[model samples]
Target: MPCWYYDKKELRETPSILDGISFETERRYRKEGARFIMECGTKMGLGHNTMATGVVYFHRFYMFHSFRSFPRYVTACCCLFFAGKVEETPKKCRDIIKTARGILNDNYFYSFGEDPKEEVMTLERILLQTIKFDLQVEHPYTFLLKYAKCFKGDQQKLQKMVQMAWNFVNDSLSTVVCLQWEPEIIAVALIHLASKLSKFTVQDWEGRQPQHQRWWDMFVSDVTMEILEDICHQVLDLYQSTQKETHQSSSPPQKPPSRAESPTAVKSTNSTVIMLSSVQQQQPPPVSGNGNLQEVNNIQSIKSLAGGVPVLSSGDAPSLPQGPTPPGQSHGYHLYHAPPPPPPPVVPNVPYPTSAWGVQQTLPPPPMPPSLPPGPSGFYSTGGRQQQQRY
Candidate 1:
């Protein structure tokens, strides 16, 4: 299926303002405090937009229902699961429980201790039904990647912009304003901040570079600037506070999500953050050595890459063919036992390559000075790097 990266008004119904639970009551429930919600939102891997929507769901659910009447954390899990389904990559139930407990333990470790895993699982079912299983919400990650690639200046400058945009995304999750804007608007704002930061970073280090303005016009919009400043200010506050506590501390035990005094049967949040914490902090005894360590390390690496534990890449790393090669470097080409299916031939007039992978990119022509003829204009423009097409 084609991946979508933005959502519009019609696709996502704007939730009406919640009134049942006054903002003050919600604030008070969190006053001991509100920051954990942001921390949990981040851990949920819902991203800024997903978290914003999830918070909206959480508030709307509670507006009519009282927090005192039923388990509120179950509602939190429901919001995240609902958002996750809406956002395409739904997290596993066990993983969600793991992370939420870890964060709660950091501050209120002693007070809250009850398993909410069952509740989270049950909530997941309800959430799926409510949204009718329509996952696939838009995210800012893709746009930032596209924007970064469009920059023609020093490669590092472009990369810095990408990184800045990512930070902007993380910061957006922490503030109330996330609830007010669409992700695309937020994305545009982030790219704008990224561009300014890129310019600033470039000027401070290497002075100005070339062709910076070529891609500048693509990002110019009134909405971009307005949201960019608002996002930047919120992100700046986050940086000032330096909220690394959630990530810094090792994952805690998978505690049930409930107050000890509460009579309700507990359910763990099963958050991925908690899973990492359990692995990192509550280290189980060594299973074995060498081979086992490599396997464990591989799992950890994939979890880190996926930003969640369960979606790990499985199967052993391929065993190397016996050949003369240096110790550290991989063989330049991999050989398979069977011949693979041939890809569709490239259409003669199209701008991109037609391979099984589809639309591969080749390096751009070498940079030409404004004054000089760069090179031969008749070079065969294949538009993609040539690979050894073995029969």
Candidate 2:
């Protein structure tokens, strides 16, 4: 019942982005990290789910950590190494590191540090803690295939559309869409996007009816064109992004110095650069000041909050009345209720968790009221088993 979904604002202003790294730069870092995970997973013969889960962990880990502090590629390796075990496609840490080394250039590979296996193992621990050990991540891939099955279309065309949607789902790992929406929602939106791009119209579906003319309605009732458009645009942005060069476009242009001032400016700039370099080298990445998941550290507390199972509060305790009662009324609060045989309290109508855990979280039936066991005087007086009062 732990909610992992966050808003676009949180995604835009991640810890790395707040630590002097631009949002675009952080995003590119995520993409490159995801790419690294995918390529490593594939080369290691891991399944799509394993790689996707690893990429998801990579994204979520950076939510609390920073790209400036941690090498994204190294973290990517750790995620894949961790994700393999979670997804049951377990791979050795050395194998993963070796695969990463083979794929990365010498400069990039140096990020692994000496004893790369140990580095990845250490990061694996941090990655586990960073993601709050919410290891079971859902991707758009499963939902895409499931929904594609429901579509009433030509077999080959449907195959192509589903394949395209599947590819879209894979591409989406590079984006923050997983952090923004549920897998089902992402699947629906991508399928809609794919259908349009592939020119495949959904004339009917498994649950064809007057009210259910649309396909998404069957899976997700509240899906809209705008929401779908936003999702599609996020995924499409990757295509546009891929075409663009990965240059430092966001850097500020240096001002030219005059001949008379050039030497002084050069010395001043050199000194300033040295000072800044030293400071940057020593300074750790900045932590984000605010977000919905500011501190998603405690697993139990998050689950309890999600479950709306609050700890006992003063408001729930029975308080004594402050003022005297009128002459016509009794001072006892229970006098008017005839509590000799009180009716059971009505359970409040709280919402069930709207996630996979919902079905598994069914409440147990209320226990039957205990009958009065005969005392020495042939009557019982208190609640609980054997007159043992429960807190």
Candidate 3:
């Protein structure tokens, strides 16, 4: 097998498309590819070791190949194809191609020709060359089981912790941590994480010790607390990032405005109005008292009334001022007509000696003279003719 390494400075510069992709995107791609590999392996009734080895093969190949040049799904199928043969549980090339096509569908398979078998065969050659035919991969699962046996505890509880650690090992393959750390280091870290989750403490079994002595000291003398802690943090971070992505993708999409409510359309309308206003202000006042002058004043009043509310263009100014047209002319000139004359000033409701037309037709009766005495008879002193006439 050949040795592979990357320069930290060069990776930070992100020289290629593969390096340019975000860590989250790469992790998701790797995870999805691994899932497909497992699905294909399951369909062929391969054992767990075979499926795991296939996923390892997939990861090892991508360290050299860019996702842009060769897609993950195709490479995934090739990994399983090669893994199947190496693990001594060989599957036919046609059967593997057929199963992959069925699971992934035709759209996902990249092919040079119409036949998917040809593509798989080509991918296998490239995969073999990429890894330099290194088929022996040490998985963390074996080490995890070995370390679990050292813990002296209830068989049931220990079994549960071991199972949890096994799951962590499987999930860790999605991360690049596996490539960076040894299998034994990852196995110990996973067991530590699982122990915390399961509330199973090693101190209870091993008893307290001085600062120099620790639990990992018993099984692997070289492993330190710092190394185990780093691995655990990496695994935990992966889970946290995955959860966040799931929440974001599951959220409802925001609704955009309809055409009528669009801000761009509204802004365009306001701009048009402002332009028209500016043009009107620049022109000299239309000849005073002319029909066009009154129309211009009405347009200004309409602008004030609109209060930035966009309306019809300047051509529609004639329809804005509301009133009946003057008798001979087709339109009225009064842009600001005073209200009607205020209804004849509201007189008191008392009667007056006036005729129907509101003009005085008769005078009021004159007052009688105070000097005249009250008399039932005609004036006696006036003449003797009164002797025979009644008084």
Candidate 4:
């Protein structure tokens, strides 16, 4: 068989990079494609070996072809479809396409064109050529199991270590580590990593040879501490990289802690009013008529994220700045709208700004109060009523 192994230098610059795709983008695509294959296969009731075979095929195919040239999602589907046949658990092309359609959104499914079946079948031939018809694949799973059997220690710890190693094998598939080392070496490295993490040191084992100084030496004489650690780092980095994304998605960014009050402090400090999310998401910070800096932490802006948002301050309220003239000077919009509308028994024929679907829609005929003098309670009055303003 042709040598499939490559060094880190070569993988760092893949064919996708040469085709104008950034290294980061290409790396992201590889992970997403492998994940797609795994998810699609799981839904199809395919075995782990079948999915692993598909993922390997995916990585190998991209090695020769550019991700810019072919869509990753389509190639992933083709690989899964072909691996099913090679692994003797074939699924129908239509069934696979249906599964993908449900998993992928319209943007990804658009690559399948009018007839997805034809798209996958046509790519199947190119995939075969790229992999050079190397249908026989041997994964680290078998080697991991074979080497693990020799480990003599707590059976439960051994089982847990084996399980972690197996997961490492699965995760390692998403990386180019498979293309850089043989399956036996990867198995040894991962098993060693798992043993160290589980704190189950294998001091004694079966088939102990006098020449071997370490447990791993019995299997691979060329293996060293550096090589094993390198493999371990490569696998561990996958978790750390994804952890950042998970953290970002989990927190859901609380609107960048609304911009602080402008540095300009005139005699009559103009306190800014802010319109936050619907009451269902977050409540506005309690602001008294007295000068108290409203808390800024818990607020999500309803505006576009292009610029800084106005903050809440308790002082003399200022009229809102007029909006830009609407395109073509459309009469449908109001150029100047005051801050939050006050109670009735005041001014009429006023249009307030509201949102329908992100557009600044106009609410017609809402009675709004004109600028009133400050009340004894230090609050602004609207029609003789001191209404507490909601941020």
Candidate 5:
């Protein structure tokens, strides 16, 4: 007969079978979902065992179904709901749904709809059938306490170590160690880690062998010091990874400038003013004797000055001046020069006269000077004439 147990090795080899989600994504969702289970259980006043069992149910369910196939939060809710019933601390589906909604609200990324009770009920049935109603889950909490009592040294120190180890076991649920290791092994490993962290040494209980050998010999032969070390490393790795993730997530984000307080708008306005000043500097002095062309040129110059200044919107940056540096300074600050304003709007001085051919004859507008090439400011003309053309 074929065994019903899943082969973890096979699953690892064919991970792509789980839609397009990577193993890292699956791990992240599992960690978050486990945390949600704990939060929900706490809000509902359920015991620690109930929460632990629920997390186990979640882990087991995901072994067969991808997180992509079913939503993690809904499945997490179903696990807690079912675990409560199996542990004889039955909670109503409605109550679980309410707690789930509250927990999800704490994270802006997730939200619950008007009703999730029906969905929770459906998932609960699927969860129960998945594990074939084998609701008995052996947690490491009880075993941790049992092993902690075996330490023969200072009572106060023992209490602290045990507490630390208990917390470690709780954090270890977020890792795959719980699924891979037995409860006794996990419990012993946690206590060993706690003792090491507390700097507490184990005392020989019996006068059998040396102090070092007695510690391992105290427990069943199945629990070795090597296994404990491996488990400890796994737990520590989990802590380091979680700390890195937390630091990254808690970092401040860069915010863009708002419309009311935009620097670009201020710069653009300043640029336009600068461009107008530069244009004024380039104007030729008024001619002593007046010729029609010179008068026209003077009029054109005045018209160019009168032309509308390029209205720089919030997106435009202020242009820098390209004028020669002062006597003492070798280099001047590089600034963008604004584009030339458009030619002044033309208005007809008089109505067109009709020719003998009965066609209206009109005078053409003066030809505009060729615009200068764009300079460093990305604007046409090194002079402020470009600012006038932009309008």
Candidate 6:
């Protein structure tokens, strides 16, 4: 079998067409990707670890495969299913297919019903060959634990950062960063950014100067600060956009003109009078009082009223920033538009289960390797046991 890593560089650096897509389009793709992962794990009744494992496997597959030819959604589903098997969690084909149908458009998702037994078997062979059968994936949970314990303040912010870091790794799979870095380094970068985002003050804020202390110097050497900076920039971009979009229109009014008289007060008073007539119609109604009504109208300008809470409704779903461009300018795919008239506010009644949106699952104890005493630095023989080995 041909090695999957033959063209790994191209996979990481090549821009997927979806990179320049609009926000809504990008959102749909994410939804598809998320759904694909969910279905793969749910099929075998596996927990979140298996789902996360699936994401890693999917990324590995795409590293060698062409995104243009293979449908990403389908590839995602295949990778997750394969990961479940490798992790010793077997799922039924029917259950996986059925669940996908329930949520996806019936017409478009019909392909799920087709038998994947043969296709999965083929993919499994390809996956094993590509990875040389290596299945061990390093997760950031351990690093997160270490960081959280060491940094006592901003526990909630640190926790959120940990989660964000985990997601950063997931997204980075589709980017160039994964090509050069090991899993441990990637984890470190993500956790570092998460800490930055939380803005948590370190325990020895003043004491741990980089050049002054050997301990601080040693800690920095274990991770790549450069990559951490890049990841931090990306994560911060997403966060800023999410914050900019405040959900409610009725947050609060600006400080009421002021306690004493000021220009703002005059402007606010004028704004009120102008809004009343403007909203009423283009032509003002005939006034009962000749001078008073005209005098009030003359003082007010409608521009201030026009500025109040301008609607930010987007035709497409919002997404994370992509490529080298500043995230403020970059918009993800916007595949579809909303109805001509704004849709009525929706109230979804179905309560979401914690597991559904991928809250971390309780992990099973990892198997420990038997102690083999000491050995040489280079590869050792299997002693004729004919067992598989992985790096």
lDDT, model 6: 0.43
Task: Choose 1 or 6, whichever is better by TM-score.
Answer: 6
Q: Highest TM-score: which candidate?
A: 4
| lDDT (Cα, 0-100) at 382 in candidate 2 | 65
In candidate 1, what are the lDDT values of residues 219-285, reduced to their tens digit? 5444545456766565544432222222222233354323322111111122112122223332211
Best by lDDT: 4
Count backbone overlaps in model 4.
Answer: 0
lDDT of 5 by residue, 1-391 (tens): 2123344564453333456666555665666678678767877889989999999888878777876567777888889888888899999887787665544432211223224676778777788878776778889998776666566778877776676667667767766676677787788788776666555677644434553464645654657677788787776665445434433333442554332221221111110011222223443222111111123232123222101111212232223335654322322122122343479456454536753223232433345667766555666654445543352
| Candidate 6 off by > 4 Å | 1-35, 38-45, 111-113, 153-177, 205-224, 236-391
Model 5 residue 340 distance off true place after TM-score fit, in angstroms: 40
What are the lDDT scores of the predictions, listed in order? 0.42, 0.63, 0.56, 0.67, 0.58, 0.43
Against the hidden true structure, what lDDT does model 1 obtain?
A: 0.42
lDDT of 2 at 181: 87
Q: Compared with the true structure, what per-residue lDDT tens digits does model 2 show for residues 1-391?
A: 5678898777777888778777776776787788678777877888989989999898888889988689877898888988889999898887787677666654355556546778888877788777776888888887888888888878877776676677777778878888888999999998887676556788887866678857788778887788888987887676545423211122232554322121110001000010122222332111121101123232211111111100111111123344544322333221121232357567554544543211222332344666655665444566433453232
Global Cα lDDT for candidate 5: 0.58
List model 6 lDDT by residue over 180-214, tens digit each.
45555556676664345344435453235556342
Q: What C-alpha root-mean-square deviation, in Å, does candidate 6 show against the real structure?
A: 24.7
Candidate 4 Cα outliers beyond 4 Å, as residue runs: 250-391
Worst 10 residues of 1 by lDDT: 305-314
lDDT for residue 22 in candidate 2, whole number 0-100: 73
* Candidate 3: tens digits of C-alpha lDDT, residues 267-360: 1111111112223253212211111223333222222211111111222111223565432222221122234344745434343464321223
Worst 10 residues of 6 by lDDT: 259-268
After TM-score superposition, the amount by which residue 332's alpha carbon in candidate 1 deviates from its true location, in angstroms, is 62
The digit string of per-residue lDDT tens for model 4 on 1-391 reads 7778888888877888877777766776777688678778978999889998999899899888997678888999999999999999999998899888776644345567657789999999999988998898889999999998998988877886687677778777767787889889999998887676556788998999998899988888888889998998877665545434333433435443211111111111121222232112333232222334256452222111111111112221222224654222332212333454356355344545532212233434543457666656668777666775543
Pairs that collide, model 2: none
